[model samples]
Target chain A: MTASTQMIEEGTALEVDGLVKRFGDLTAVDGVSLTVRAGECLGLLGPNGAGKSTLIRSMVGRVRQDSGRVTVMGKAAGSTEARMALGWVPQELSIYPRITCRENLGSFGRYYGLKGQTLKDAIAWCLHWAALEEKQDDVAKTLSGGMKRRLNMAAGMLHRPKVVLFDEPTVGVDPQSRNRIFEMIEALRDAGTAIVYTTHYMEEAERLCDRIAIIDHGKIIAEGTNEELVEKTFGRRSQVLARFDGETAAIEAWAGRHGGRVKGETAEFTIEQAGEIAPLLDDATKAGLELEDLTLRRPNLESVFLHLTGRELRD
Target chain B: MIALKRDRGALVLSFVLPLAFFSIFAVIFGRQGGGTPTVKLIVVDQDQSQASAALVKGLQSESSLVVMMKPEAKSKSAPAPADYTAATAEAAVKAGDAPVALIIPAGFGQHPIAFGPDAGGSTLELLNDQSDTIAPQIVVGLLQKAAITSMPSAMADEGMKYADKYVGGFTPAQKAKVDEELDALRKAEADGKTGAGSGDSGNGNSGNGSAGAGIVAVNVRAVVGENKKSPMISFYAAAIGVMFLMFTASGSAGALLDEAESGTLERVLSTRVTMTKLLAGKLVFNTGLAFVQLTAMFLWGWSAFKLDFFSHLPGFAVMGLCTAFAVAAFGMLLASACQTRAQLGALSTLVILIMSSVGGSMFPRFLMPESMQKAGLLTINAWAIDGFTKVFWRDLPVTDLWPQVAVLLGVGVVLFLIARRVARRWEFS
Candidate 1:
């Protein structure tokens, strides 16, 4: 490999340290730091106004940080070299509505210095990748919301940069298109392109991200793998929920010994391990508690986000 | 109430701007109904004689003429040389320094003013640029009135000179008879009576001489180029056409702000293209749009009013292109300065209405007060209208439009530079 290519491979594909951006008195992105390795997908999860967009913007050099630094592929952010290596998909639909899909892709591709046969090839590939080959000649305004969102992604990815950032790419898309977008992202990741995806959907983050960062109030309050975060926030405990057929004052007395609580005919028990669930059920049965339904719940990112931030993931 | 508060700028412009312009133009064109509008004339008196002085003073006293000339020096010992000459006066008119130049030739006061079909009538030459159709006519009419008003005195003066030369040698009795006959003729002419006096029998030979000497005529000659006559309808058509063209160009230029709001501008900025190049592309497109609009309007005028469109196509094209470029640059500057489309609309409307009102688009600048006429020179509309007047009214050659073209293109370049600086936010914001 060339020395520059080898050097890029040795460092993180994207790195941000102590990045702070303020608008007037509000710190939009407060001293946030993160890194994404090559071929790894880092999902940025946050509620509205959680500084996710600001952080993403700073990473792409769209907004200058008040402090600290952001670098892409070993180059400073906002530099031409860094910009040439970065791809961004903003939350809003940024395609030209009056132009055809093919023309929109071609125009954006040219902005990236793609021209001649290379530009045509990129446009053709993006049309097929976005599943818009048939509708390539139609004006973007006439497309459905899902189609436009897909096209928005396709436009950003035409350059095939080393680092790609998507800011809430599937906010208002249909389920089918959202799944397709997820698949497309997965393909990018498998192709060894580092990705930073931001979304409010926890399930999407849990399924797609290799590591997830939960941000709140302009700070990354928590960052880890899904299981690591769950264990760190809530310990290795599982909850067993039992609905009784009748009122069970007797079961409440037995379950209180095992760190469980009873409300009316339902009993909820927090156990240290999954093996403890059977013994608790045996005790409940011995206490003459007639159970109608029982379910075992494991801790997840949603609960971890709640446990760490004391708020829901989407709040 | 919410909508009103949201669009307060448009609200203010819709009501306040119209009322303001109306009050202004009403005061300007309203009082013009009672009296003839004055024409600015420059006079060069080559003949420094009594008759020439009297003619100049008489024209100066006329309400319809504002005479401008170099004043004589105050020192009687060392008088200042005359700075104004016939060539300079003619040049002044051609360069639009004044509407008309009235040159009194040498020896104009020596001969008797001729009123009838006399061959050697003293001619007062009026030189005009012909851009102004109405002003020249007014000047000509004022000259005619001045000549007619001075006729009786001129006839008496000639009659006295004739009596001194020919009748001086006559005998006292003969001279007394001739005097008695002249008094009777004067009384007869004044009493609405036309009959030869009874002394006609004795003074019949001198009667012919006295009668022939009493008539004086003045001829007024206009020096103007061919095809310089422009009808009032055609003038207004061109004026109103350019005024609305500015409005339309500004409106179209507002599309830049729309694109910004829609995120397309931001998307384009994210590309490798620099902001300056993008703005330049937009300027070119808007300028072309303005040019096409003006061309269509002129074509319609040609079909409707028989305006000389094809005859002066070269000059017209130059004027249209330069004016379009300036107007487009102006519109883009407004767009770049304003943050929103509504603000652009209101502010551009206010500016264009004021400029059009003061710049001879709605009313002739010649009819405005002198102060307003000077103020009109500060607007693009003034230069644009002046250029079109050269092509359509004066029928001037294409080369003559260079001054207007230079000013317009220069303004366009300057405004585009300012717009480029102001529009940097579109790339970074």
Candidate 2:
């Protein structure tokens, strides 16, 4: 898989190396290196104010970095060629509320030097892709929050760029809107448009991202496929917690039977399967130890992040 | 088009507020000023003669004043009219309200010829509170003429004595009549009743005057443009226009701040929108709106009065463009620096008021001190309105507007560069 991924360059969709950005004395994005390959969805996961927005902005040319390079389709970001080859759905819904969705799309397309027939066709394609054909003529301000988010997506795609970047796209939205956004992103990615997605939602990242980079405090702490991240933490094992209301010796006997060391007064241990948790709890009960409760935690991106950062994924 | 549609309310208000202000000015200063202006005059009649009475009558002709008959009384002790007081009136006039009062001293008619026509000692005392600046000036002219006309024949006779002194001779019979008059003057002088014996006290008997001496030569030519409409109109128009325009500009630029707050600017930026293109779009829209507003005001001025809009079209165009460009650039600059709509609103209000006030929007630069007028030239409103007046009132050619246009354009360019610099900083940081 690694050899195949390396062999298929297919014109690097988006690439950045050693990018550094600073605001006054504060370093926001420090020596971050990243890439989004063609036809792939790459998710950027981080806590609030962890430089996710700043990194995305730098990639799109909305921000100019102090050092390093960003390129879209082998061209520098903010250059005409790079901008033409890239689409952006910024974290904020930035359409003019009083203008119709069609007008907003038209204006955005025109900014990319598209006009007349080409512009019209682009608007039509965006509306269809976003499933907003019926709402094209409605003023953006009048649309529901979900529809507005969808229209925002359509606008970003109006110029038909090969690479698209969504910065916290599903943030501050309803569950339905978030799901719609995710579906739209998946559809775009499946159509072979490379996407760089940033989100604080670990679940969303795990579900949607082909590869993910976990960032904190202006640095990428880890980056890999979801399975790779999970393995890095769980190591072919599962976590089980058993509540105890008795002396430590009884829980220790159960831990011995499970082939795991008892770590906490709460009698926490790790096993390779859920069946191990029940047997350990029964043994503790038989030894006259009160087995108050039992729980088994599965290996996921959240756990991987917790192991890496020593903090929960969702703030 | 999108920008305009999004800011419909703001755009409408920008145009409406200026039109409303223009209408208010038209109604207030138009041919029907509603009523006569009141001017208070303190009458000091030392002569206590019929001639002085006529002068007093002329002073009372002005409608503004409730004439105080005392020589010198404290303004505080003497109550003003119930509708408005002298203090408030002065403040209002300074603030462009038309209230004024005059004080005529006892010797005003007594010594009409005390000072030469060109000398500084011309003593027709008019103590006005500067409430209504124009009123004092108009009443001063009227009183000067009335006082000259009301000078008693006795003073005229004394002026004739100086003429006779130059002429060098008199007949015996004329001398005899002068002697008879001098004896009557002596008798009246003894009784200290000069008012009762005016004719008898001719200059002869005192030997300090001559017969037929009072034939003073007076040359007079009517001055043009006097007693015309209020001179305040030009300054007033400029003041009202600039004030309204500043409000309009500030209100319109507030839309930019709104875009920033609502995240629309960010969205737009995300899509291939450069700061230059965005600013260009805003400038074009705002300039067109400013022109339309100016045209409406000129039309309203014409219909309301004979403002002669066609004659001043070229000048109007230049001034309008200069003003529009400067204001548009200022708006852009403000939007680039400000973080939110509320902050922009507060900042704009402060900026506009300062600019308008110092730029001769609230007061005429001509009425201001020389230093202030020199400083006023630096303000965008002063030059723009001055150009407008040159075109509208002075009937000058469009070429003359280049100076004003250049200053305004320079200001616009400077502001545009500042806005660009700030915008770039904002985006990058």
Note the Cα lDDT for every prediction shown. Answer: 0.77, 0.66
Cα lDDT for residue B349, model 1?
84
TM-score, prediction 2: 0.68
**Predicted candidate 2 versus true structure: per-residue lDDT over B1-429, tens digit per residue:** 687556644554456546654643443334233433333444444445454555565455434333555323348678543433334333333322222333333453334443344322224333343213444444454454444444434344454455556677567787677667755654553443433222221111211111111121122111211232433344355556666766676667667778777776666665566778887788778767766776676676667655556656767777877887887777778777877665576566656655565577776554443355576677778887777655554445788678778888999899888988887754555
Residue B395 shift from truth in candidate 2, angstroms: 0.8
State the lDDT of candidate 1 residue by residue for A1-315, as single tens digits: 764466576858998899889999998888899999889999998778889888887877778678999988988877778878888888889888999999999989988899999999999988888899999999999999999998999998788888999888998999998999998889999999999999878899988899999888899988989988888776878767788775466877876877766766767766786787778778878877777899888878877776667667777
State in Å the error of residue B421, model 1: 4.1
Local error of candidate 2 at B43, Å? Answer: 32
- The alpha-carbon lDDT assigned to residue B44 of candidate 1 equals 86
Rate residue A102 of model 1 by lDDT.
Answer: 95
